[model samples]
Target: MFLSTILDKPVCQPIKKPYERWYTFMEKNVEFWLPDSEWHTKAHCARVLLLALLIGHQKGLSEEEKDALGMAAVFHDSRRHDDGIDKGHGSRAAAYYKEYCREHGLSYDAQTYYITYYHDQDDSLGLSEIAKSSDLSEQAVLLYQIFKDADALDRFRLGPDGLDENFLRTEEARQLVDFAKDLLQKSNETNA
Candidate 1:
């Protein structure tokens, strides 16, 4: 088969030694520098990657873009802790990605050479720019949209008690966002 199809054995995680080290350092140190909010947690980033990969794979993103999506998820908020807000997380992510690529033998630039550009909701236009700059047709924008919305879904909601009304505008994101909002409303009622 041209594809691996169902679970074929694990080839292993893609990151090499230097890449692993840089990530380890970044993960270990990023939190103390960030505010103690749900927006800056490692767990949040992990889920964002999972959601991106789920949508990307379901939609058949290339192997490189798939890998870049995960890298982008990790790096999107990598620099937010340092600045006390998400001010330039995308560019910071880009710089960090470039450093990681250079430090290792990787052959791509985080900014100009990859399909995934790590961006926060605070950097929505950057997300739009990355999607436009990529080789995706209109349909593939759906993949990027999923990633963007999924991350936004996580940010504006946290379990059954968290919901943000403004995020429910798009039909694509409506189901997830509405479900969360309903759950939050139910929980509030129950508590009341």
Candidate 2:
């Protein structure tokens, strides 16, 4: 079934299925940096979270990797000031994620931090930095690519020509283009 089907029903209605936990968690927990933003709201984050998990699963990510991806998805845009190319929102979101995890007594994953911190930056620059950091594992680099691709998949919300398949980091993400467009359309309908 299309993932968008879940949002077709009332937001309060229970959804019992795979990935439902993340869906519920995002609905209850995601806090937008620009709460009133037309483009960067909870719905956008939730869709990214779902896309990340789907791509992560296809890439054989471990539970720990998936955890980092989930965190990155929810917080990556949590600090955006506006929809227009907010250059450093990723870094702000990364800092917020660190503080949030600390306040909640959750373990802070560097992979998550790096992914969120550099997601909005240029891919070559981000990967170059990751390559130079000896502390970051190859898995961190993979997660970064996966997380970015997940975020990119949701670009359909920006309208036609918003997403370019060649820019996606993973073939898995490329495969989801049609589904992403459908999700955005259905999500808009549900919210409207």
The per-model lDDT (C-alpha) reads 0.50, 0.82
Worst 10 residues of 2 by lDDT: 9-18
Candidate 2 TM-score versus the reference: 0.88
Give the TM-score (vs. native) of candidate 1.
0.56
Q: How accurate locally is residue 62 in candidate 2, as Cα lDDT from 0 to 100?
A: 86
Full-model lDDT, candidate 2: 0.82
Root-mean-square deviation (CA) per prediction: 9.1, 4.1
Runs in model 1 with CA error above 4 Å? 1-38, 82-85, 109-118, 121-124, 131-143, 156-192
Show pairs that collide, candidate 1. none
State the lDDT of candidate 2 residue by residue for 1-192, as single tens digits.
Answer: 225575444431322243566666656766776989988887888788877877887888988888888888888888998989999999999999999889989899988888999999999888988888877898888999999998999998887998989999899999889878877887787787
